[model samples]
Target: MNSALQKSSSIFRTAAMQVRHTSVTRYIGTPPQVRISTAEKCAHIAVIVGTILAGPAWVLVHLQDYKK
Candidate 1:
């Protein structure tokens, strides 16, 4: 069991590292052609926040409906 857990964590660490490398290489290395303004940046942030919130919102709605 200990060995299995160690192997799982090792695999996860490798996958996480690969994802980080890919994201940096794909986005961090690129220069933006049209730089986003502050308002645009705020909007993008809001969209991301809303996307994250949506999952919880859906779960809450379902729970409410289930109680009815």
Candidate 2:
């Protein structure tokens, strides 16, 4: 039992050391800027808003069935 405990503790220590080395992140530089036309911007906003509202709209439309 003592040996098993030592083995598990050693395994956990090695895993912790590996995790410390792997979690490093280096930022290179600023990302490039993107340019979009007014129409394209409007389309993107419309799509995003539509997606956000679709779920609630669906639930409201089917709320009676859910209550039943």
Candidate 3:
């Protein structure tokens, strides 16, 4: 925190002087390139499929009970 408060210009008076380069590389890898393992992929697929099935079943059950 002390280092951050200090001005970069105060440390190096010369404009031409090359300060240390801070690399912007992510500590964690980029998202799209990240791989999902086989079991994880299956689990995700199961949730989507379950939602699809459950939604219709839920509607049917409620429609029976709450008929106009």
Candidate 4:
């Protein structure tokens, strides 16, 4: 179990290291396992937030139908 945890943490560390720190143009050495660009990250966030909001928003928009 401890070994598994260590392995997991190492993977996470590598992933974190691959991420872009601040600048969009400043490149890190390792090709990121994840999207490292600011635009890409923002787009990903937007998609996630939109997806999350969609469920509740849709329900709210159609909520009157369930009232009967």
Candidate with maximal lDDT: 1
Better of 1 and 3 by TM-score: 1
Prediction 3 TM-score vs. true: 0.40
For model 4, what is the C-alpha lDDT against the true structure?
A: 0.85
What lDDT is reached at residue 10 by model 3? 53
Writing each residue's lDDT as its tens digit, candidate 2 over 1-68 gives 99999999999999998888777544346764777789999999999999999999999999999999
Clashing pairs in model 3? none
lDDT score, residue 66, model 1?
77
Backbone atom clashes (below 3 Å) for every candidate: 0, 0, 0, 0
lDDT of each: 0.92, 0.90, 0.72, 0.85
Residue ranges of candidate 2 with Cα displaced over 4 Å: 1-34
Q: Summing lDDT over every window of 10 consecutive residues in candidate 1, give the lowest-scoring window.
A: 23-32
Task: Write model 3 residue lDDT over 9-68, tens digit each, in one string.
Answer: 555644434332333332556577868899999999999999889988898989968787
Better of 3 and 4 by TM-score: 4
| Model 4 misplaced regions, further than 4 Å | 1-35
lDDT of 3: 0.72
- Winner on TM-score between 2 and 4 is 2
What is the TM-score (0 to 1) of candidate 2? 0.50
Q: Residue 64 error for model 3, in Å? A: 2.6
Candidate topping TM-score: 2
Q: Which residue pairs of candidate 2 clash?
A: none
